[model samples]
Target chain A: MIGLYIVTGVALVISFAFDRKKTWAGLKKGWMKFYKTLPSYLFLLMLISFILLLSEDFIIENLGQENIFLGLLFSLGIGSVTMMPGFIAYPLSRILLARGVPYMIIAAFVTSLMLVGVVTYPLEKSYMGKKATILRNIMSFLVAAGISLIAGLFYGELV
Target chain B: MKKSTRNYLLFSAFLIFSFISWLVQYDFGLAIWDNFLVFARDMVLILPPAFILIGLFDVWAKNETIEKHFGKTNNPMRFIYSILLASTTVGGTFVAFPVANALYHKGAKYSSIFTYVTAASLFMIPMTIMEASILGLKFTSIRLLASIPFIVIGAIVLEKYFEKTAYTLPRVDQK
Candidate 1:
């Protein structure tokens, strides 16, 4: 996150140096875009928090507690629907992996958590168009599943 | 309803629910509040600069330039370049989506945009390092390697599928 700020800061300085008027306009445009999208983000945050609270136990238990197929399905479903920042999701997956959970389930959860965002699909559609948003999510879901299956096989020793 | 008002209503509804939960059970309310605050703080940490960079990208990069680089072509170089650019980007999926949309509006190919979106989420440096440290090098390596071909293939298929979709609105054309 600090890296993002530093890069943004430097880019702003360069933008200003190159063209003051354009830079100001760009900043205004940025704020407008940010503001325009802020509501969706806030709504998602609220929904995610509530979902997180409700699923705290459910996720911990069902993500890896069943047959491989069911566990994979559960992980993919939960991860797809839930919106979590990478920071939180990665560490949580790590903990799950350390706890003797199937790596396939952990992989599915982490991959889907990053790639598929059902919770934010509307927000994504606002930008990418409805068809494109749905297509992207479907592709990501399949790719995430593929990644998990491959990881499961290649890293079988870990499991 | 106005967009702002609609959003405000949604937020207030959630707030009311939280308050009622608090009245019914203190810990539930506190937990909800804590989760919201954590997300809010992370958003504060990331959104400002991410959006600013996006704004700068809009101001500086030209539509023709984007098209020239990422527009429909069978050129393998474009694929490599698109993946590299998106993979190294700092923010997660949400932050990358608008930038990819901007590129799309600028006439970049849908496949390239899809590739960028997937790569941005999957191959971020900070996230990769974190995953490696936590999940072990073997798991991280295998997953990363497995994902590349799928991302490439998915990008091409999506591009072909969405080829008819028109570019919506260019930022520079936004008045």
Candidate 2:
């Protein structure tokens, strides 16, 4: 947490320093502008609600019973879509694990859920350009896989 | 960002996602090579409506009012509020994008919006706690710690690229 804060601070300073005028004003004028956009935030909440409702069934079935690979694939698949709130995903995941899901697959699912979502493609395209969005998502997805693989190995060693 | 009024587009996407999710469940329910296709289908269907709503927000929101409050690129508070709002949030990543994008258009700095995305991605308090218990402190800590740099860097890059476009009203003097 602290490292992230420090990094964020440093990055903010460096980014602001590049275009001093825009950077300086962004601290104030920019934020107030964001405040006006609060209603947009609701979209996220709505998405979460939908996922929680829909995935309840999925979670009930697979809890405490997943392997690392399956978890990974589940995460990747879900992450690509962009739905499934952490609230729903985590509990469902825990249940799946308790039921018999492999650790690797659960780890994979968590990574994918957080790292990538296919549904966001259009929005990403508009905001960051299509190529940038695609490349970034791809890299993030790959990282998710790597993380799951390492996690599975570590768990195996510990047990 | 005018409303596309293409209601059918969103409906179609929703139906498609639903079908895909169903297909994934059926194909991999027992075999379990990877059930990603199911989740992907589910998430994709939800985005079209999210996009349409975002388009409306973008078109209707007053840029001036936004600039007056949250348009600061330098203020630390900008960062504070962004993380607060985003980290506290829970939702699908796909749906979150356009809403954030709309805010960006209304003058929210890219850095702030990026923070929102990153925070939202990992903001589940209970989940973190559970992860620590199940996965151990070392694993959870390592993952959380590593994510910070990624989030900060991602936010920084986004801010740089998303230069604010001055919002001017129709037939009004450019301020």
Candidate 3:
């Protein structure tokens, strides 16, 4: 994060040096874009928190080892809809692993969690349009499933 | 209703729901609030610089340059460039979206933009390091390797589909 700030600072300084008016215009444009999207972002945050709170226990209970296919399905389903930081997600996956959820299931969960964004659907649609957003998510879901299957076969846990 | 008004209404409804949940179950409401605070703080810290960078890119970067490298060329190197650029992204897709939008308006091909967006989520350096530490290098490596081809293919296929349909991106007013 600090790296981001440093880069932006240097860029801003250089931009201002080169052309003060254009730099100011750039800043104003950035602010306008941010302001326009602020509402959607707020809604996304609220939805994320609510989903996380409601699904925590349910996720744990459903991702057990009794049924592999069911577990993978649950992982993909939950992971696609929810968004959390990597720190929280990795630790949660570790906990799930300790509880005997197979590597394949965990891989499916993590992959889908990172790649697919059902929760970000509206926000993405606002930028990329509905067709692109839907296509991207669907493609991501397929990729997640494929990667997990490969991980499963590699770990010999799918059988 | 206007889109912004609808969003505000939905946001308020969620807030009210949280309040009701708090009344019924204090812990659940507290968790939601805490999560929201953490996420909001992260967003506030991260988003401004991202937007600023996008703004600068929009104002300064030449359209001809974007077109030369990432535009409607048949060059496979564009995908590589897209992924390489994406790996440098600090925040998640939130940042990537605006950057992708800037690139698009600057004449980048749809396939390249899609590659950038998808790869942005997967190839962040910090996230990869963390995943490797927790999940083992083997697991991380396999997933990364698998992702490259899938992302490229998916982007290409999606681009083809869009082209066949003569689809154009919907323009939201910047002002």
Tell me each candidate's TM-score: 0.90, 0.47, 0.94
Cα misplacement distance, residue B146 of candidate 2 (Å): 3.8
The candidate maximizing lDDT is 3
Q: Model 1, B58-118: lDDT tens per residue?
A: 8789877887788854456767777888877765666887788778776787778888889
Residue-level lDDT tens digits of model 2 in A35-82? 332222333333434554455676455433335445456656665554
Better of 2 and 3 by DockQ: 3
Interface RMSD of each: 2.5, 12.2, 1.4
Q: After TM-score superposition, what is the CA distance of residue B37 in candidate 2 from its true location, in Å?
A: 19
Write out the backbone clash pairs for model 1.
Answer: none
* Candidate 1, superposed: residue stretches over 4 Å from native: A157-159, B16-25, B164-175
| DockQ for all candidate structures vs. native | 0.60, 0.07, 0.69
Model 3 per-residue lDDT tens digits across residues B1-175: 9888899999898788778877888786878888988888989999999999988888899988899889976677999999999999988898888788778888899899999999999999999999999978988898889889889999999999988998777554367
Better of 1 and 2 by DockQ: 1
* List of chain A TM-scores, every candidate: 0.87, 0.61, 0.95
> Cα lDDT of all candidates, in order?
0.80, 0.53, 0.88
Report how closely model 3 matches the true complex, as a DockQ value.
Answer: 0.69
Model 3 ranges with Cα > 4 A deviation: B12-25
Q: Docking category for candidate 2?
A: incorrect
Residue-pair clashes, model 2: 61
